[model samples]
Target: MDIDRYLGPGHRTAALVTSHGLAVADAAVRLAEAERIHEEKEELAGTLTRRWGTPCHLGLQTVRLRTGTEEIPEPWAGLSLRVGDVYLWQVAEQGRWVALGVADLDPDDEIQLLLVVTDTDPP
Candidate 1:
């Protein structure tokens, strides 16, 4: 249902934006979480969706892996990925792999994406 009457679609430009995990460039993590929510939303929502007429698209997650005594690898082991002034640490290890949505895709390499800034934390 296109709500063009009540809310018209418009064009806008953004110099920067980091919401709903839009700053994350980890394709695997983003996909995993996106899929996880897709499968679990209905189950988790219970009667919330039915009553509200909208599915709650949840985001962000953290979990611990039973690695025992094994050593972690680079990128994943460091616990964070930094882009510009943003530092995105914490992943499947620290039980915090969030999907920063898709900030911007590379024109040359479509697969490459520029995730959100994570250097500073919210006060």
Candidate 2:
């Protein structure tokens, strides 16, 4: 499952197409619409959790790393991440990590789920 099909090129992320056949929505919710967006994200997260198993239970974790930094690893090394309030999950079987978060993608703050293929855990 190539993530490029959903997220475009230049993203060194993996795909979360588990044996359960997980699929992500191509469209993102606008972050500016506070309350409504929150509900939408929660609803989406709930759906994902049910199908993808439980997420990494971290009280408060943020992935703060630049695109070209040593702190980042392969599959995520080329990706610029500035995520807070993230929902993380480790797909041990596939040796991959998935994180669902909101990104400030210039024109809009969009909700995105990134699947990173890594042996190590999230930093």
Task: Give the top-scoring candidate (lDDT).
Answer: 2
lDDT of 1 at 104: 25
- lDDT of all the models against the reference? 0.28, 0.46
| Superposed Cα deviation of residue 99, candidate 2 (Å) | 1.1
Off by over 4 Å in 2: 1-34, 57-70, 74-81, 105-120
Cα-lDDT of candidate 1: 0.28
Q: What's the residue-level lDDT of 16 in candidate 2?
A: 31
Identify the leading candidate in terms of TM-score: 2
**lDDT measured at residue 67 in model 1 versus the true structure, 0 to 100:** 25
What does the lDDT read for residue 73 in candidate 2?
47
